[model samples]
Target: MIVFDLACQPAGHRFEGWFGSSEDFAAQKERGLVACPQCGSHDVEKAVMAPRVGRKGNQSGTRNATSPARTPVASEALPPEVAQAMQKLARMQGEALKNSRWVGDDFAEQSRAMHYGERERETIHGEATAEEAHALIDEGIEVAPLPFPVAPPDETN
Candidate 1:
């Protein structure tokens, strides 16, 4: 007996069927004797065979098992569109932050002072909690969260 992997066309359900031989399977299919066990549909065909399986150390009649995983080399590699977009955004952010000062944890306080005219208004970006951001917005302060986290300048060294 032979086992054939069959798939139903309408529902795309795969199943195995037993037959006496290859000719037997073909005859049964031609005569419309094959039926999908799930939906009783006669439209069925053999499913695509997957990769072969064998013992890990077995090397006979098989491709090399020790080859390194494929990695795209420079010049041959292509940058994804999203990667290009992110690069452009990073460039824009770097330009924006070129003149902005980092206030570390005192982002909310300094921002509030600038907003209320207690201090001169200037471009600034720093860490602020969700609650602090919400409070700033509630008090009519314009604050936007940075798309990425920044390391404090003092910590970089």
Candidate 2:
């Protein structure tokens, strides 16, 4: 799965859209399936985003140009409590999905089957385009996305 920075053409609201692949995003956009969450506009397109890269040399005293112009913040800007809580949440998620099936990009189909009673319900997780996820929600399907993305087993290489 991949995430793209998206913008609403009408309102110019910038947001993120997750997709199984670039083609999935294109197909959804072609069908006018993606809408801006802020303004409910379907005229959405990919927005320019800076790639996240690690610091070159050391983390001593350096700031990237992309960061908003402001006084330098120490690494401790994020409270230790908040950081620890986030780590705990990640561990909990990992444990929860230890036995879940990785259905890769067939998430929408598999979820719909279970939702319509065409297949028995079971624990499963996989990738789906933002539009697909929204569609499932609209159909009252009990599907949800993981807080953090997992690498597909087959693509781990």
Best by lDDT: 2
CA deviation > 4 Å runs, candidate 1: 1-79
lDDT per residue (tens digit) for residues 86-148 in model 2: 689889888978878988889999999998899998989887877888899999987765645
Per-candidate TM-scores read 0.49, 0.52
TM-score of 1: 0.49
Quote the lDDT for 56 in model 1: 62
Error of 2 at 62 (Å): 23
The 10 consecutive residues of candidate 1 with the worst lDDT sum are: 73-82
Distance from true position, residue 11, model 2, in Å? 19
Tens digit of per-residue lDDT, candidate 1, span 12-80: 988888888888787667645677766668899988866345656655665577977679654323357
Model 1: per-residue Cα lDDT at residue 118: 99
Global CA lDDT of candidate 1, please? Answer: 0.78
